[model samples]
Target: MDLRSRIEASYKRIAQEAYDKGYADSIKDIMDLRFGGMPDESLAALREIKDVAVMRSIQNAALSWDRDEVLTLIAQSRSA
Candidate 1:
């Protein structure tokens, strides 16, 4: 699959698993399974988000939490 499709699929799978497990804190576990544990840079970047909506947008996307995307999203989220 293409990158976007892969991302969407992974997101769906993670969401389903989280729902089935009744786990609200499954984001880290999902990210680890989708992209191998979260990188330090990504974690640092995620720490910057202050808006719930923007943070949810990033969370809902299929995109992997690689360092650059993480930082970019966090920056955008803070601005939003």
Candidate 2:
């Protein structure tokens, strides 16, 4: 690739990684407050999720759904 394209690709990758980390941290924060705390395994699994849509959906679900339901979603997301 050209230098410009290489730079753009690097920037995009960095941006996505930052977004994923920030989103994952926020998810943990919300879970801690809403559910008292999350299981360690689930928290680790959540960090492994690269899909922002799935992460956001889990975060949104945690805000309203019961702890059990949210846990189920997290587990499934990790598997996917």
Candidate 3:
């Protein structure tokens, strides 16, 4: 690929990795607060979320409540 195309591809990859890390961290926080370890379904659902802000919101929500409620909020956001 051309230099410009390579640069754009690299930027996209970096951004995607950062988002993935944020999502993983949020999932870990939720798991710790609820199940004390990662749960497959929750992890899968979190992977489906691409917005960092929404993932952060779910992490915040987990601080106050259980996993189901947090998942419900995420699902609602996805549908909207």
Candidate 4:
């Protein structure tokens, strides 16, 4: 690809990573409040998600659902 295209791709990747970290931290904060801490498996699953929109939706869901339901939503999203 051209230099400009390469730079744009790098910037996009950086932005996505930043967004993922922000959302993942939000999810962890909610989990900590609800469960006193989150399970390692759940944290792993959250990190595995690369889509920022999915991460945002999951973070919102985490506020209301129990841990298992949050996990189930992650599992279902992966299958889809």
TM-scores for every candidate against the unseen true structure = 0.44, 0.87, 0.62, 0.76
Per residue, candidate 2 scores C-alpha lDDT tens digits across 1-80 of 99999999999999999999998899888888877889999989988999878887888888785678778888898777
- The whole-model C-alpha lDDT of candidate 4 against the native structure comes to 0.80
Q: In model 4, which regions exceed 4 Å deviation?
A: 78-80
Tens digit of per-residue lDDT, candidate 1, span 1-80: 89999999999989866553332134445566767766565555565544455556556652455534544665665455
lDDT of each: 0.57, 0.86, 0.74, 0.80
Candidate 3 residue lDDT tens string, 1-80: 99999999999999998877777676676677676765666666677777777877787778776667677866776676
Candidate 3 residues lying further than 4 Å off, grouped into runs, are: 77-80
Best by TM-score: 2
Q: Cα lDDT for residue 66, model 2?
A: 68
Better of 1 and 3 by TM-score: 3
Clashing residue pairs, candidate 1?
none
Candidate 4 — worst ten consecutive residues by lDDT sum? 71-80
- Model 4 Cα shift for residue 42 (angstroms): 1.3
Instruction: Name the candidate, 1 or 2, with the larger lDDT value.
Output: 2
Pick the lDDT winner.
2
Query: Would you list the rank order by lDDT, best first?
Result: 2, 4, 3, 1
In the predicted model 2, the residue pairs found to clash are none
Q: Model 2 TM-score?
A: 0.87
